[model samples]
Target chain A: MKSLQEQIAGLDDVLSARLGGTAVSLQPIPGSVPVIQVVIGGREELPIFITASETQVLCICYLWSDEEVRADKRAELLETLLALNPSIPLSAFGRIDKRFVLFGALASDARVEDVAQDVIALSDNALDALEALSAYLV
Target chain B: MSVIGKILTLVRGSAREIGESVVDANATRIYEQEIVDARNAIMKAKSELTGVMAKEMQSAREIERLRKEMIRLENLAVEALDKGEDALAEEVAGKVAACEAELEEQSRAHANYALQVGKLKELIKAAEGKVREHEREVAMARTTESVYRATRSISDNIGATGSKLVSARESLERIKRRHEDLADRMAAAEALDKETSTRGLEQRLAEAGIGGDAERRRATMERIRARQAAAHKDA
Candidate 1:
């Protein structure tokens, strides 16, 4: 099988059909690794970033940054995220320094539909996370 | 520490400071090497399992040879007894007993080797699974660095001039606006319903100085004043 990066890079027309009505599009972000930014139809505000190595396919959707977070509600927001993590399924809350993100990983050999599902789920989860935690933002 | 462990530690120290350095290059390399080590461990176990399997085959062969020898000796003992050679029969019987004991020992050895083979194979299988998981973690950690750079650049671009990526606040703003719109729509619907009702028509007529509550109130006020004047005159 091709690397997940390449496979995701080629996920243009099929995932949209898989999603039924929601359009799915991908852009190959040029960098050190093969990272593709996927913007699903309904969740256009949240674009998922995916890249794969020999062993794993990782997808991440950034929710917000610390700078965006209100200082007074920071603790409350962190607590909310931790409390909500397990229930969200498939994805976990993580912070990339200042950026808060929801990340999910799967084996590199997963099918394209599986990857699409992961991306969709992650994107949905990200939007929910943002909306639920919006009060914490500046 | 694992890359994830390192990230958690850094995050705990100060989430703000844990940005691009969550899994440094060295930590990532170390993590990749751990996958290599796990694979090597599985290979060693496989080799050991092979050795155990070989020992089991040899022990099985030993047991088979002993059983054949025992069968031959028993036949000889029976023949000696039939030919009126009691002492020869006793000697053959003793050799047969010795063969039985050795056969029992070989069987036990083979069983132990078989058990070890099963255990080693299971261990190797589990180790391989662990290695695959670790490899996945390393892949994610490495890819995350690229993500880190990309997001950093995005953040910079947004700060310099807004990008296509809408902020969370913007989405929230839209959501709030929708709620406000719903409130406004509800109020407008109520007003429209009232405007088309019979009561609304009466109120509009009164306000327009047509014969309604306004004229009746004016006549009642005049009658009250006349009654007050008649009472004053009688006083």
Candidate 2:
């Protein structure tokens, strides 16, 4: 079995290969459960936190807070998210600490490049959802 | 005001004001009346064209008559000169000159009349084309307006039906959830009954009577052994 650092290194290699020269890095945050901060793109990098075990790797991107949504428009915003959830391949909407998030998970044995692509795609979808629902946000 | 005074006041209104009021009061009727008036105008223009053509023909005949008259006077002047009548020839020559000038003026008048007739004919043709174009445009406008109204109505119906469909789907989802809950409850109840029922291992063995069967077989075997012993003693 590969150590957690070695697995993260392997993931970093895959991300580098898939994104060409887009600059991807994985930095470990010391904790009870293993956590890695994944930074992709340029100097103003968007960070995605990844938690991994021997069996699965989960990736999460914070989108917005519930407080940003207007009280009257919350229901419409939630409905739009629910309606869009099934169509967003390999990712789903979730709430944590009163903040909306986009997340996806893959088996550790699966292709890291494919999961990285999914993470990028999910991030784009999250940005699009924010733009579409901006009218309902403060 | 009295009815007669009201009537007199209405009669005293300007013709254009009365016409506008009538058109406003009876729009559809006025529209049909306008179509009739337009047709009458076309007929009147056609009659005017015919009258101009008739006047042109009369001017042509007058010109021909003046030309014949000038020729006759020239012939008379030539005959007076041949007969050695100098005064008569001179008088005829003067009449011939006067007739030539009159013919020139009449020819000019005839040309002007012909030009007017041609212009009037062209005007009538143009007016006819305009009338037909206007009729086609009005008809197309009416059809387009009707189509627009129908499309709006269909969109309204779709909006109404869309809401109904959404509510129906929500109701179906609710019913499905309730059915699943009821099925889970029934399954749980059946499992509970099986767990609490009093049929245990000893009760099932007693129902089969295994202990009674073993006692009967042992008694039969002992009797058979006793009979064998008695026969041996007697022998």
Candidate 3:
């Protein structure tokens, strides 16, 4: 049972060698449940926060909030998200409170390389999601 | 509701494993209560299975005891017949008959209990799988709640130059900017590559008076000028 911190550290090393880009920065979000934010280089705008529970290791990227949604198109935006869920291979459309997000989850014991790959896919998917669904935004 | 339907169906559908915010607190509470009820049901079934198994064991013991008593009575009857006591032998035979009947009843009861145990065990196995599936949903809800709190904290100020609160629109703009920047760099490098190609290098060398064609032309023009100057002076 590897900790989420160890997973992220392993992922950082893999991404560093594979990408040859700037190093990924891991910041801890001050919360009770131990969450860490991973900002990938060249895709820093879409920072991903990863956390763990007893059952799963979860990652999320906030696409937009309720306030950013067009006032008349809330339902439409949600419907689109539901429809778009299948298109993004590794990520899912969801919400954390009023803030809509693109997220991925793996078993608590998933491999570090798998998590790293998911992060990259998730980051790219999030950017594409925002662009594709910007019509619903204010 | 279908798994891919409206937001109202998100928590109750198959898509729950992927996670979505539980917008209705009341609904979520009822769902949690249902999980508790199912858990209780599983516990009840497990205890009932234990009781059935115990009964099966008891039936086996009774069958064994009755068989032993019947065997003893048959031995007595044989002894009575050998001594020519017909009435005593007949009485012993009656006792053996009674034990046989009792053994048959116990054997039947044991079989039924064994069947019930098998069924209950299977039921419990299936129920456990379902409960685990629902528990995963509850786990997802808790995780989503945690994410909500954490993201709420991070959403302090939007677009504060390296801040976490950057909006999606601004983030997209930044992504595009980085893409454009990379494109510009690539174009610049390609242009530099072309400028240093074999043709461009040869042209550069000609301008510097060290190449074949340009040196020959310059020398030829200089000789022509010298010849004209000499012919004019001679004339």
Candidate 4:
């Protein structure tokens, strides 16, 4: 069985290449739920993970405090992002604190670069990570 | 002397004169009559004053009662408004307005009721006109309804007669079908009789051996019998 850490690391490598501001690290958050943080678009790398059910990929992101994003607005962004990434099978989505959890599939054909760009577009920044992930997955 | 002072002096003099001698009958009589007359005049003045005060008091009481009633009505209107009972509020408002108008009219109508106001008759006349208009509307509706009912009855009768004719035609077709069925039975009986006769003839012909190898067999038997008899005789 592949460990959650290894899977997260694999996802991080894909996210880093697609997003490309050098991956700061691919380390596990020490807790019941597994989480991997990757740096894209300068300093802040967002956390991504597989949920407890492993039914979907949990992408947790924080809008920088000055960005002042409301949850409903963020949920709208997540919906847009999920729409753009046809490769990912989005199942469920939610917002906690300031982070968003997008539950969906992460397969070999997943468009990581486009997902990264969608994230950047959803944020104030414009970064396309899906393109970098395209070669790695295919 | 001026009128009131003159009357007062005459009254005082009459009182003094009466005190001098009750037995001086003429003077005493004048004094007594004057005193009674003065007392009656004073009493009349007092009664008139009392009447005026009483009327003022009654008017004040009426005004106070009207004020309290108006306050109560206004409060009721407000409460009705708060409850969103605008219709009720308007009804109460109409009543209050009518009461105010009536009060004004009543005030003008009297000093006393026998005194008439011009506006009162006009209001009554307008109200009567409204009632007449409403009655006219009701009568017109009744007339229209009668006409409608008459036309409907006529059409209904025609429709019913037509429907009855359709029903009768349907029944007549059913009877004709029954008659045709009887004819078909009679024709079937005739066909059956012909078939029976033909069958009887065929049975009789078969019994009589008209064909079907029976004649050939009979001829062969006769020849065989003859040959046997000839052989027997020869033997």
Candidate 5:
């Protein structure tokens, strides 16, 4: 069995091969999930945090949130986010650290390619959802 | 007929003739016109599709701008709150709220436009496919019409040639009948001439009493034989 770092490195290799010119680097943070920063399309770096336990490696991309969501629009935003969650594959909208985030996770036995693809999908869906829910979020 | 009636009759006659001529000469032109109409329709649809996509893009851009503004206003509100400026934080919060509401509406519009663009693109694609199919059908129809025309012409020519052959055969039969009739008449004339010549010789022979000559000669020979036999007996 490979370590979490090795699995992430494999995922990085696959992503680099699939997405030409995409730069993938691993940044280990003390006492927290290790972050994989991916630069795609020569744009801003998308940071993906990964946590590995005994059985599963979870991948997450922290999207925007409305911590100060107005009382009137909170229900509407929650509904919108809920509606969008099921539509985006391998991703969901949930509150994390006082902020709503769009995130996805995969099993430890999952292929690196699947993990990389899911990470890309999760990021894309997060950005898209943020754009979609921008008016509902503060 | 009155002058007005005559004019109306002439007009109707001319119109009918013109209609017939037009129909005869404009088959291919009509097909071309249909294709042109379909192409125009496709172009219009394509233009509409492009407009829908442009609207979708615009809405998406608006939503993206509003999202960025919301993020900025939220950060500003957070900073104001940290600095103990409650009024400023409230103002920034109000701005964030406004931006969020606008962003939500724009995002909804963007999603709707995206759906519209998708449907329009599919429609345009289907129309293009139909146009191509119709074009192929028109080409096949033209080829088939040409082949049909050639076959009709060949059939007409064969019919004409068949009639000519029938007439020729009839003429040959008439000539053959005439030849047979002439040969029969010549034979009859020759027989009549021979009988006319032989008729005088037979009449002369009858007139010279040659018909009784053989019987009379036989009787005279018999009488001489009997007299000779009697004389031998006397001797």
Candidate 6:
């Protein structure tokens, strides 16, 4: 599995490129979870979640901007990043075999343990699922 | 009334799946009971049929005995007539005819009882068939109820989570906006105070009439005013 630092770096690059003129930042949460911040149209910084393990990786994006347009932009950035890299399998990172759950939401708890088991299990990552979210940005 | 009801209407349908789940559950139970009742009825009917069959067999045996008695009486009548006893012969003949008629009636009664027993057996078999049919229906209903319940639960959870997330985000944004507004007001107030102070300083300098002139000219003007005032005092 990619280390939290490496994944954050990759995310920073991907988000920065996809959203020009937007400053993006990534920090590792206390427990090796990577938290991403993307400046939406230079207006608001949106936070997203990415979890990686040996066998699975999950990503969830939350809308942080209060303005509708900035929210839209943040959503677009999320969609683009997900489309470009998709969710990388933790097994591909070597030696990580546990399930990784990624949930994107700023107001709601991003903590996986608090969420319902079925919801986490339903979370899936694919290039296509990311692309499919693009239409929802507006 | 519940979120689940609204969601069910949207996805499954208003009239169909919503009520169908409960209906199906109840139907499943009812059919289950129906199957049990049907089996019981069939069992009772079978028992009744068995009893009727046994009674009919007994009646048939009685009819057979009567038939043999009639045959023996006819034989005695013929023997009596051959011996040339007219009165005795007449009496024997009458007894033989009466016995034959009675046996015939008994045979008819046996046939009727056998028919009734056969019909009862058919009814019992039909009831058993119905029990099997009811069992199949109950199974189907149970499967449908389980599927519906699962679907409803999933939808309810999704709706609950989605609304909760949205509400949390709205509240956070509200708090952040309030903070920003307070900060903006404070910045604007500080700027206004600075502007007011700068304007007061400009008014003071203008009243001294030393505002916006060449530095040397203002100093010279001040020196002349001071000397003229001193000379007037000496005079």
Q: Please report, in order, the local distance difference test score of every candidate based on alpha carbons.
A: 0.76, 0.63, 0.78, 0.46, 0.62, 0.51
What digit string (tens of lDDT, one per residue) describes model 6 on residues B13-78?
A: 442344244344565677778888888888888888888888898888888888788788778878
lDDT of 5 by residue, B85-182 (tens): 99999999999999988988998889898888888778778777767755654554432233223223322443654732122223334434665787
Show the lowest summed lDDT stretch of 10 residues, model 5 chain B.
Answer: B163-172
**What is the C-alpha lDDT profile of model 3 across B81-193, one tens digit per residue?**
99999999999999999899989889999999999999999988887876776666666556555555555445532333354566789889998999899999999999889
Cα deviation of B87 in candidate 1 (Å)? 7.3
Evaluation by TM-score, superior candidate among 1 and 5 = 1
Model 6 TM-score (2 dp): 0.37
TM-scores computed on chain B for all candidates: 0.57, 0.48, 0.57, 0.30, 0.52, 0.53
- Candidate 2 — which pairs collide? none
lDDT of 1 by residue, A28-113 (tens): 66654567778776456677888765557778887776788899888888898899888997899987757788999888787777
lDDT for each residue of candidate 2 in A69-118, tens digit (9 for 90 to 100):
78999998889889989998888887543556677777766566666776
Candidate 3 lands at a TM-score of: 0.70
Off by over 4 Å in 2: A1-3, A43-45, A53-55, B1-235
Sliding window of 10 residues with minimal summed lDDT for model 6 chain A: A91-100
lDDT of 2 at B227: 96
Instruction: Report the Cα lDDT for residue B98, model 2.
Output: 90
For all the candidates, what are their Cα RMSDs to the real structure?
Answer: 9.1, 30.3, 6.2, 49.4, 44.3, 23.3
Please, what are the lDDT tens digits per residue for candidate 2 over residues B195-221? 766445445655675555556777888
State the DockQ of every prediction.
Answer: 0.24, 0.01, 0.40, 0.00, 0.00, 0.03
Candidate 2 is graded, for docking, as incorrect
DockQ value for model 3:
0.40
lDDT of 6 by residue, A1-138 (tens): 445355344455455554553455554433222332222222232233344433223344333222322354665654554554435432011001111113422112222332222122222222223233333333
Question: lDDT for model 1, on a 0 to 1 scale?
Answer: 0.76
What is the lDDT for B171 in model 4?
A: 30
Tens digit of per-residue lDDT, candidate 1, span B1-235: 6657744565465533333565677867886788888788888998898899999999999998998999999999999999999999999999999999999999999999999998998888888888877776665555555555555544554465556556778865664576578789999999988777967778789898887678899999999999999999999
Give the least accurate 10-residue stretch of model 3 chain B, judged by summed lDDT.
B1-10
Give iRMSD, candidate 6: 14.6
Report lDDT (Cα) of residue B117, candidate 1: 91
True contacts kept of each: 0.27, 0.00, 0.48, 0.00, 0.00, 0.00
